[model samples]
Target: MTDTSRRSLLGALGALTVSAAVPPAAATASPARATPSTPAASPSPATAATSGPRSSMTFTGTPYDTAAFARSSLGELTATVLPGTPVRTEIRHGGQRVAVLTKGARTVLLPGPERTFTENKQSFTDVFDRLVPDPALPPAKRLKPGWGTSPSGGTWSVYGGTSGDTDFGVHTKGAATMLLKDTEAGRYATLTDDGISDADVNCVAAFDKVPTGNACSFALLFGYRGGGAHYRARLSFTTKGEVDLRVEKVMNGETTLLAEAGPLATEVRAGDAWRIRVRRKGAKTQVTAWPAAGAEPTRPTAEIEDSEAGLRSGRVGVRGFASPGCTNLPVTLITGRFEVTAANWETPPSVTHRDWVRLLDAPFDGEWTPAVEAIVRGWAGSMAPDVFSYAMMFLPGAPGVRGADPRVAGADVLGEAGYGKPDSQGLRPVGADFHDYLERPWTFPDQTRRPEDGQRGNLDCSGYVRMVYGFHLGVGMMAVKDPAKKALPRKSGAMVDFAPGVRVAQRTGSGGSAPDLGQLQPGDLVLFDVNDVAGDPEDPDAYDVDHVGIYLGLDRAGKRRFLSSRKSADGPTMADVSGASTLDGPGIYADSLHTVHRV
Candidate 1:
């Protein structure tokens, strides 16, 4: 978690008529009104765009597979890199080709497409085959399976493992290539014509499961059986003062640490020995430490602890090595490896169902709207969804002003250096904000005469709810800026699972680092209960339910106004937390619970 600021609604809040923004008689004058034909070049009527051949097909959980598409007219084909081996995703769709490998965010084309994929023609079994590696064979060897049979549609599934092999299981039913790689970070991921790099402390490798830090690790989680996860990592060495500690967790080669802490002690003295262990049980992760002398007191440090209880974990191997320092007693994760029995993955964290009545542990404070739920549910069902996780993963980090032309978010978003894309409904954070403004039908500079319009931006009420509902996943915030953004690309991930989407309750909080609750910051999502004095239900959304909100800090009057959108023409924004009872919505918004998600 790191520093973050809440996004303030940019445009002034006043409705405006669309007609007024259009040119009138004088502005719309024909070229005939122009003096002597000086090559009249008045703007001609813009033609309506013809719809491309898009079938009316739509998906909420899984995408619809177009008629077995082998031609370039359809789309791109991608692939995953094997551990130790540097792999890339190269697609030659319709000749408009592009190559993308693991570089965090921004995609790059290999020097030449033909040359780069010459060895991968065999990897081209089917579109989904791109998720794995294939070689030795050519495009002639193709495997076509029954199209409409799979419950999950055609999006290729991504995983991590071996390289340069054409033995990916394509036709063999139930056959899977065991994706094996060093779990901890600091293992090198570079590709040099030869073998893959090892995660020798100081070396960097991609991680399968980690909220932060570059050290790679894994766990076999028990959760939903849906989609997969995306991961990244970096390795670094830091220098401290007196005791130069060597520590390498995925490092970007930046940030000067007081001292670096390597996997093992920077120096092994005459009688010193190294012993360590790391494990993940659900949302909690434990790391124990010791020496050749045996279990030392005050040694085990809590790495990740979100819930109250501990959990059942796996084996923890020790990474051995150390490059001792001299005068200043240097420290660094000299070079080592973190071993694990398995990799546990969590699914979507934010997109979930909430019932306003049961959320008692946390305070139900956010403005819950059925319209928002409806929209989320709609989108979740439309895409191959577990729920909201995928939506949030695709959401923009910043919103744009109404009059501002939408642009490709284009790495403008923090942490999402390579993967952010843009579209109308849900694209860039700024675009979403601007669209929200339009839902308000907020005023435009040129249009002064007409106001109080019901546009997406100029909201009277309901439109705001609709737009917000659609793009809540698209809202950019402090969470998106954190290094963890790359670790967990699915915005809808749960504390443990992230297949379809995340559980709504876990999607709040801010920064790349944690924060104190008393000092509430902006862009924090507060989930709470809405109830009467008797603990009975109270209609927070007027539809009899619980709710949540994008916390705007403690309001000026000390009262908080949660920013939210619901299906209403005119709704109360600055509602009193004391009065609004969280009766229904996502059940997580209870009376006792008041956890804030900082994103």
Candidate 2:
């Protein structure tokens, strides 16, 4: 644990934007080259840089900028599921379509429209098959189709594959606990971070969910050599950039909230803990801090502070052990489980087309919406096919759901966005390695904007921030027009220049590398300037403000998550940015955290 100071945090709150420049390669490919801080290479997805299908998805009605792409293959699994219902999902990829209907897992066959119930062929149910048909091979070679069969004309067993980010064809729950192994990574994890090392690991916990927006959480307790060989237990979670909050401890349904390193708030004491009682009273979970536990002499008036994190989430989970920018000593997390309450968990109403659109698009600027919402919203939707599907890593239903907006109201937002699927290499958005991938062509966006903005163009440095938080209605006023745009004494009256609140913080940059160590906060905005104006993590330069990400809590493993606005890793987009893609990464020039604003 670490102790965070107050004054230092306050001084760190500045509202500056960075040059939106990226590396010559990053502008084209967003160069990201980082190594894990944990042992054996296992860390949080916050730091795992890779690419994914840039689907045309709106935020929780609220969320980035990237390129649009040709979504020729962006279909998803759909089921009119009931809460607490159990169902198996089967996906076929590469050249393979759907397997046989009611045969043994191994006795499956290809489907056809004119060819049903005969010739040992599989039964076809969906219409997509009749139109496009299977690739005459395995989808991704993930499953050992036809047993001992290789669609690529090989002798190895071919499993199905994904047109999305995760690959390798085979994914299943491990032994110790319900865990998913990437198969290629040679590591089985609860969070499925693809993190693995030969270091001495003791206990291992099971990752049930990856917080909001696909960022998973898991804990590890292991013994490693850091100064001296000792045993340390730490947690890990995904983060946007820095951090704002951390779940210190959860007991008897009560949780402790701590601002690990906030620019507006004080740092978290190595042993300091905030308590939260989980009793859903109305729209929020009632949480009160600093109560008289036993009998502490007199109740001092030092201001009992408390914070509330949505079960749905504002920025996924707060960054825990890993801050997306930290590379601390090694400490393994072993034997644990993750618990996540869905934000959009109750998704029944949105199950239908009309309800789904209204549930997300909020006050859309245009009539066009997206189809990816039906799938992505599952994380918080009223119904979860099964936590295991995501928590343990399983596939969605096969033959993928088929439907047409026919309304054209939002027909091919995904196709128009150019949301292409990833290769079988399990490509992440961050830099597992800079400038590379395993499949499909990827190009960064020229400009990024709000799909709901009703207008188009890129979001300037500060504008990026205003737009991101703008998703939250009452977050503040700076979300729309700059408060500084107003007259003198522009304090509370203007959302332009936020006075000094207790938590929200920001930073901006225009040149030179970011600041040196001695400075960094959990939820501080990271603005950078890579090529010209400024950018954030998406830039190759030290201070590029053209991008933005949220600060998530850490995990038991201590590997940080760095969420950001990418160039659709695979194509062009409307505003050049959209959706919240949580990848593995860290902050830049820890010192570059310039302007800190607390609101």
List the global CA lDDT of all models: 0.22, 0.21
lDDT of 1 by residue, 328-403 (tens): 2211221111221222212101111110100111121222234322322232212121112111111111122212
> For each predicted model, how many residue pairs clash, with residues at least 3 apart or on different chains?
165, 142
Model 2 has an lDDT value of 0.21
The most accurate candidate by TM-score is 2
Shift in Å, residue 440, candidate 1 = 20
The true-versus-predicted C-alpha distance at residue 317 of model 2, in Å, is 34
**What's the TM for model 2?**
0.21
For candidate 1, which ten residues in a row score worst on lDDT? Answer: 115-124
Candidate 1 yields a Cα-based lDDT of: 0.22
* Model 2, runs deviating above 4 Å: 1-468, 476-480, 484-524, 532-544, 555-560, 568-592, 596-599
lDDT of 2 by residue, 1-599 (tens): 00122121111110000111111221112122221121122231212111121111112221111111112124542322122211112323343333211101111112211100000000011001010112343666433311111111111111211212221122212112222222121111221111111111122232233323222223221111111121122232332321132323332334344223222123222222222112121222222122112222122111112322222111111111222332331212122211111111111111001011011222112111244233232322222111111100000000111112231121111111111222332221222100011111122132222232211222222322332232111133322233333211111112223322222233323454433322222233333322244334563232322233333223223332222223232221111112212222232323333332222
